[model samples]
Target: MSRIAFTPTRVAVLGAAVLLTAGAAGVAVASGEDVTHPGKRIGTQDAAHPAPAAKDAAAAKAKPREAAALTGSAKLFRKTTEDITFTFDAHLAARHNADPSKATGTFKFVHLEKPGGKGGWATGRIDCLLTGGKVASATGIITKTNIKEMNGSRVGFSVHDQGKKDRLGYSWAAVGGPDGTKKLTKCNSAAPFEQVKKGTGDFHVQPWKLPYPDPR
Candidate 1:
């Protein structure tokens, strides 16, 4: 048996590379965005697995609570905004599921940003919490990850600004399931994130933003 050699001419190389990337179905990887890990431990942990009925009830109760106090731009963007397809460094500081304790990790996303001039904006998606509610993943666009799981495992994140000013904003993942009902719990119902400005735009290379084939 002979192994096939893979070589290509430069002309269609870029096009072929794109096609190959597209064919790889969004298989995820770690991101490197946040440089000096920021943020505080704002998560909790739990050993008991609450029933779906209870979880739903908790989500219902927590929704209003989060809304009532709205901290960052998460609230406004969550409704009127949609994630743009781009690359960015996403910093994450997670906590325990049973106790919602603080943990960290670097994540990469085919990030999505809200439409319109985001005063400078960025958006990213991650698997975050696992089914057992034990693992929380944070994949970034490029570079390396600074992800530190609740168990103390850590990864670095690499990211860059696409020349947009809005500082890298942060939000919380409320619930993500098989159903389309997955929602991102805003870090601040009022301002989920601080809108970055133009002189503050950023971007990266390694973890390129996935192409989200949808209308703006």
Candidate 2:
């Protein structure tokens, strides 16, 4: 994990998937169907893309090992609930000795939730998972404010795709929060992005939220 001090003028910047999981993917019967989101019957390819994308082959061989390495790396965890907050990681060797009541560990959402015209984002949640020490799967809906930007203190999901030499198609977005109201507000979304392979990726963010869905 590398951190560059952020300044007013010189702020240094560092740094997909879908409901469609593996095994759920299928082949299209007719032409003009979406090979990406199969069976759903969106569209199809004019040509039969039988040749396995070289990108997928490479990712198949590499992602697992990369995930393992990330799982073993030490990470920081902080919980926010109300006025009480607790932060821990390789950076902090000392356990913060503060009045638990004063420091909260949940998120407070303000200026983050922007409802999508009619279809409100609902039925979403986030649960970060880690092993050995480092953050492996940030498995949950990361609120816009809680998300770690490219220049954030934390490193992005290089743990998932080791073959990714460029940051083009390697970014992800958040889901939802404690309340169902504020859905996934994407931060630093790398849109119009394509996967190098057929797999899911994790979304990293602040371990905790601060009074999310802030009453405005």
Candidate 3:
């Protein structure tokens, strides 16, 4: 019996065949394009690319909602004839000396002139009760006027407190307008409140709520 020795050419051929088979298998796995399985493809379904419009729509949905428009009645009052002032009590004093105390004091929205040269005017008085008091008293014709957005309206006005001079400030948006069912919404002061002069001791009454009607 003759023994046959393996030649380098034969060894190279065998190695090449093994490598070709392995390379083909590796490419199929890496490409992830299995024609046999139509459902399978490159990358992943869950990680699929998003359309430009779809991305934009998603961003729009995430954005904050636009605020409601002001009421017709609220649109009437465009000016004030007198100076508007906000009195602060101990609570307000502690908050920033300018913060109108939800605790005690009075917020008077007085002499609010009508819009469109109507010449009609109104007033509002919000009475702050003692600490822990429920439903403080409010009065005056302006009281009926919506200073907030809904029942309230956001109006640009000035604050004439002691510490802060006449500085422009805006009231919170009320729910309904003056004619709306939800009347007299709360109007919290924004900004410039921090600039108000700090007060101490018992609550004090200050002459605020001056109005200057807008010229028609």
Question: Among these predicted structures, which one has the highest TM-score?
Answer: 3
Candidate 1, superposed: residue stretches over 4 Å from native: 1-163, 172-192, 197-200, 203-216
Q: What CA root-mean-square deviation does each model show from the true structure? A: 24.3, 22.9, 27.8
CA-RMSD of model 1: 24.3
**For candidate 2, lDDT tens digit of each residue in 75-172?**
11213122211111211111221111222112111221222222111111222222223222222333433333311121112222233211111123
Q: Write model 1 residue lDDT over 1-216, tens digit each, in one string.
A: 135665666547978889877554333212222222333221222348654568999888865211010011111123445543323223222223322112222333232345443332223333222211111123222233232121222212212223343223323333221112124232221111334333322332222122246897
Q: Which ten residues in a row have the lowest lDDT in candidate 3?
A: 67-76
* Candidate 3: regions farther than 4 A off: 1-102, 110-122, 125-142, 145-164, 172-187, 192-216
lDDT of each: 0.29, 0.26, 0.33
lDDT of 1 at 13: 90
Provide backbone clash counts, one per model.
Answer: 77, 35, 34
Query: Candidate 1: global Cα-lDDT?
Result: 0.29
- Better-scoring candidate (lDDT), 1 or 2: 1
lDDT of 2 at 195: 29
TM accuracy, model 1: 0.17
How far residue 178's Cα lies from its native spot in candidate 3, in Å, is 7.2
